[model samples]
Target: MTWTLVTIPASHYCDKARWALDRAGLAYIEDGHMPILHWRAARRHKGTRTVPILVHDQGIAADSTDILHVIDAHVAADQQLFPAEPALRARVAAWEERFDRQLGPAARRLVYFHLLQDPALTTDVVGSGAPRHERVIFRGLFPLLAGLMRRGMNITPAKSAQSREKLQALFADVGAELADGRRYLCGDRFTAADLTFAALASPVLLPDGHPVIRTAWARVPPAMQAEITAFRETPAGEFALRLYREERRASGL
Candidate 1:
């Protein structure tokens, strides 16, 4: 059966789902959509108002983490995101959950606080890979949508500063975990923990050649770029980027 992955192409969580599908060597069609407009598709597809909904033969996986579990079920043991050993799996799950709950939102708010200020640039970033009509709609109605996003995500200057502080603390913790010369987040080999961290961190780290990074970096604000540089210098940031460089692969869909 041909799977269909619904996504807002520029979204980090969507990228996380894509990476999971790719790692599983599962072929699927990417149904890309715009941000606010994606609700229609998500609702029609029987998912919550979120991207990265994987529609498969059996049913739909409504969340990125759910998609990973779905992909893990079909792949070989070695390719699974969750380890077979109970202890290792628990550790991996803990790290993945922490990154999802903390790192993901913080990175998103910090990045959007800057990107939403420049509608044209934000349009380019969010509209890329969307259908032409959706892109046009997004560009035309960006102001209203941007306002909704800011309000919804609380993307104020104060909130953005708070997100930065949160990231600093989280990254420090991740760095300290790596102080023992461990290669990956949970252990020696890659797991859901590493994937979640890298994908969530992509917003701030902007590792080269990421689907979202391609259109964003060229036009990133100077202040954001400087912040990104600082992130890249951190041990955790370096680890995420390294995973992107070495582990990220084409979906082949």
Candidate 2:
């Protein structure tokens, strides 16, 4: 059966799911939606209020990690996101959890905090790939949408600052891990940990050729651009970018 993956298009979490499905060579249709409208679409599918939901003949996956498992089941053993070795699989899972909880939210809040400052940038990046009507609605209701997003995500100057600190600490940790010259997070082979980190870091890294539209590096605020430049120089950030260049092209996700 053809899988239908619902997403906000620019969401890092959705990209994670899309990458895994593509890596596993699963044929699927992507139904991209705008922000608030995505909640309704998600609810219609499984009474859940989140994107990156995957629907197939067997059942529906309401989360990105769940979608990874579904893709794993459908693909050959070598194509699995989870490692075959028990210890390596456990390590991959642990890293995925940490990045999912810390990296994803912090990067999202930090990026939105800056992007919301420019209505045009917000519309151009977030509304890209959405239906024309949805894009129009986003432009018309930008104020309300921005307000709701700020409130829901608790985006404030102080919170954004805190998120930047969190991101720095996480990147430092990843950098230290890579210092030993390990090719991948878990071991020699690429696994979900690498995929999760790279995908979730897209907001800050603005990875080239990402499936979603991204703000130009030059357009980012001066301070934010400085930080992004520093991040791009870090070992962890370079690793993420390399994954995008090599693995993403291989998967064609």
Q: What TM-score do all the candidates reach, one by one? A: 0.97, 0.95
Candidate 1 at residue 104, lDDT?
Answer: 89
Clashing pairs in model 2, backbone N/Cα/C closer than 3 A: none
Stretches of candidate 2 exceeding 4 Å from the true structure: 250-253
lDDT of each structure? 0.89, 0.87
- The segments of candidate 1 whose C-alpha lies over 4 angstroms from its true place after superposition are none
| Candidate 1: count of backbone clashes, pairs at least 3 residues apart or interchain | 0
Instruction: Write one digit per residue (lDDT tens) for candidate 2, span 1-253.
Output: 7789999888899899988877777788888888887888899899988888999879999988998888888887876889788998999999999999999999999989988988877877887767888888888999999999999899999999999999999999999999999988887888899999999998889888577744467677787788788888889999999888889843333
Question: Model 2 — which ten-residue stretch has the worst lDDT?
Answer: 244-253
Q: Which candidate number has the best TM-score?
A: 1
- Please give the lDDT score for candidate 2: 0.87
Report the number of clashing residue pairs per model.
0, 0
